[model samples]
Target: MIRRLTALAAAGVLGLSGASATASAAGGPPLFTDGHGLTVVSRPAWVDGNERTFVFTVRTAQVPAYSVMEGQVSGEHTIMVTLPEGYDRVATRYPVQYHLHGHPDRPNTVVNQRMFEETTVGVPLITVAPNGSGRGWYTNWRYPPAALGPQNWENFHLDQVIPFVDANLRTIARRDGRAVSGHSMGGFGAFHYAEHRPDLFAYVGSFSGGLDLLSQEQRAAVIASTQLPGSGTPTVPVESVFGPPIWPLDGGWNRESPAQHVGPLRGMGVAMYTGNGGDLTVDPLQAVVENRAWATNIVTRDHLVAAGIPHTFVDYGDGSGWAEGCTGKHAQPSCLIADMDHFVDLLMGTLTHP
Candidate 1:
């Protein structure tokens, strides 16, 4: 079925509303605004070699001052969606993969660069990437400064995006058909979502994810992210993000830490991957970053192991010899691609009804 959709999309037909390939190439107005405050803001294009792909800009009430997109700072943000093949003509409903982007990143990165559509070719899934804020940490900040609007990232993804996608797209709309995964902070998000709301996701994955939020360095990293550009003016206080940042369970950080809350993920499909933070090609500092994530990943893996939770853990050290083209680790694309492949493979066995 995916092959048929690919062939049709390659043939330049069946885009949303039956627009011509030539027209879609230009990119046009909104396709439709769903009830969830999300509007299809671009023409469906054959992006990254996939069929029925488009961008949706959502104006969520969750975070009134959400992260910026297209250089605009407002409550609204963009999300890139890659619909499954045969979505328009076929009546079959497909599983949903919510691919959250990392801190300091937007959903457009996934849509434009190297492209997820390229990876998902012939894979029967509807991939959605929501622009989690650059510093929101995918959590409902414990104490967002009263000056800036709320930073309810967790609510944004769970309450707003999920329902919008399920209602607007032909999705299975249940736990058996839903999966979440991410890179870096997104990796944290994958586990965070699975842990807090186990009923919403059947599979969870993190690629170089900071799984142990309670870890000293990991806590510092989250605090540092708030200093980055998208965290908004006045810089959301670290306490708002994770309590006092003091001892073991400071500011409710333990509540969201993946390692501390692995019980809900027992039966769910769990997979984690990280390199030894050996990306010499990138900034030398990236090594430190990846090394920290790798260390935290090990802690989480140990927790999962101790809990007897069945999961796939890949400690592909440094990525130097992981594969032919693999070199460097941490935020490298090669590692992320490998992580995505692994997650997809795991999802294939669990996602319902194909």
Candidate 2:
């Protein structure tokens, strides 16, 4: 049965509604007002035979946030949470793994579903995927101007979504019991969260993430890929994301780029994977872009190594050339599935139970 609650009631439970006596003492700005609160837009349903999934709509003060179509923010956003195989059967709480979707993909996608199904075969971890609204890039916006309110992606996920999940689910709910991973843009987000908020996740993984955002080449690629074809308008601009990308000088750019913030990952278990862009099926132009991203991952891996941070790097060999490695291109379901399985195995082995 679907369980629905009034916005006020949900806010009270989340400590965001004015009705909550604990609201003032919560130590942070409330995400919702008395009239705004999270709601279970859908009931829990089983998928792939075992996984239980729920859909939720969360109210955020950060509206007018960037949308995929450019220059827009969605106030009420949805997130999908999937429980472990035996969630209902067992009374024990399980560790949580937050999976982020790549650019242009929402929280719920066939790729994410397939990856989750294949990766959690023997592991028991609850997975959550919050929508990034297309071009949010999983980072708090700097261009559209914050004066519009806190349309920050980082705040939404770390502050509101995590709290909502913990309040409603049987989760371990701590750094030691949590991990984060993502593909492409999501990979960047996973690293960003882990670096910026090391207290939140014990493990982090990036698959084909554009880790080196400060590099001119990377910035160019970002602009190219995000541009609206034929119109030549950039959907996500460097100025909007992290100021001017003036490498070595742009404090904002350096602050958010994973390559520049490798210090925080010193003790965290990290995993990174990328393909050689050898798949003939993929467009040649896209292949170049993917290869460049893979190169960026390589640089990030080197930084981690130099920082004495232990991490796992998987180079799924080139598709066009000869190399011994996993087969799949960027966004290829097979490669993504394999990478998630490998990373989840690593996470499951290290994560502690409550």
Candidate 3:
């Protein structure tokens, strides 16, 4: 039978374990909670058998409320966590791996945790996967202010979610204690977070991610993501998150692309994976997507080399990831699992995962 715990943060009260020092022993106080005003209102509910869950509150509500007086639930976000096996049985702190999901997605316990937990079986680490918003782009919106509700995903993840996790959980609570990884768009998010705040993470990995946000093809691809198939409806209303994807304003694009900012990743462990025109699972077009990702990653890999930042780059060509029952090489499970297997190994080598 499944067990349920009492609501820790009951009735809007911040119910965190004030005595985690006892549980974590040598592990220091929570890093992101003291100063950060985040509240944990409930206990975790893992939809999947492996991963646990946590629903916390953010100070600023990025998305507006549907009904004015009702308030916004987006302010109260969900971050599903996968604790080390025997977490309840042991009293120790562990390193955290923040896994980001792709576009048109939410923080899913099953979809995200399955690959991570399966690959890291017996490994002592925590996997925290937060709701990054469908088509959130994982960046602050740069244009179309009126139509889209306040879109500030970067601030939500960096300023709020990261700290909140550090606050409530028995984490290592430092740069060396944390790592970030993502698939497809989340892949972009992982690198973006690592590149922007190199101090917060010790390792970064991207599986079939869009590292070059400045590429014209990538820019157009994002535009296409906003619309639905067949119906042509505006699914996500992503106007322009990277500032006009064209000339004039487009010049500003280089300011943030992970490929252009390799210096920040100097000492950090970096790993990336993608298929080279591999299995076009759904259709031939899927191959095009992987092909595009491969192109962007090559330039990014070269940038890392130029900056003397050592990284593992795998362009597992055609018939690589798909043969394992996955749809194909682009943004399916097989590729992400492969990425995690290699990345977790790299992370274990650097992080204090005992």
Residue 259 lDDT, candidate 1, scale 0-100: 78
Which lDDT tens digits does candidate 2 get at residues 236-294? Answer: 44466666666565777677889778899878889998886776465776566678889
Task: Name the weakest run of 10 consecutive residues (lDDT summed) in model 3.
Answer: 63-72
Instruction: Please give, for residues 296-334, the per-residue lDDT of candidate 3 as tens digits.
Output: 898899999888889998777774443474444576667
Best by TM-score: 1
- Local distance difference test, each candidate: 0.73, 0.68, 0.68
lDDT of 2 at 133: 65
Model 1 C-alpha lDDT versus the unseen true structure: 0.73
User: What ranking of all candidate models by lDDT puts the best one first?
Assistant: 1, 3, 2
Write candidate 1's Cα lDDT for 1-354 as tens digits: 112222322322222232111122233312444556444444334444444576656666667775453475566677888765565556556779998887667777642244465566667888888878777788888887676577788988898789877665667778987999998888998899889999999999888899897798998998887665554444666687767788754848877888778999989999988888665556667788888898898999888889999999988886866654555556777667767766776786787644
lDDT of 2: 0.68
Which residue pairs collide, candidate 2? 64-73, 65-73, 278-319, 278-320
Off by over 4 Å in 1: 1-31, 37-51, 67-70, 110-115, 230-234, 279-282
Task: Name the candidate that leads on lDDT.
Answer: 1
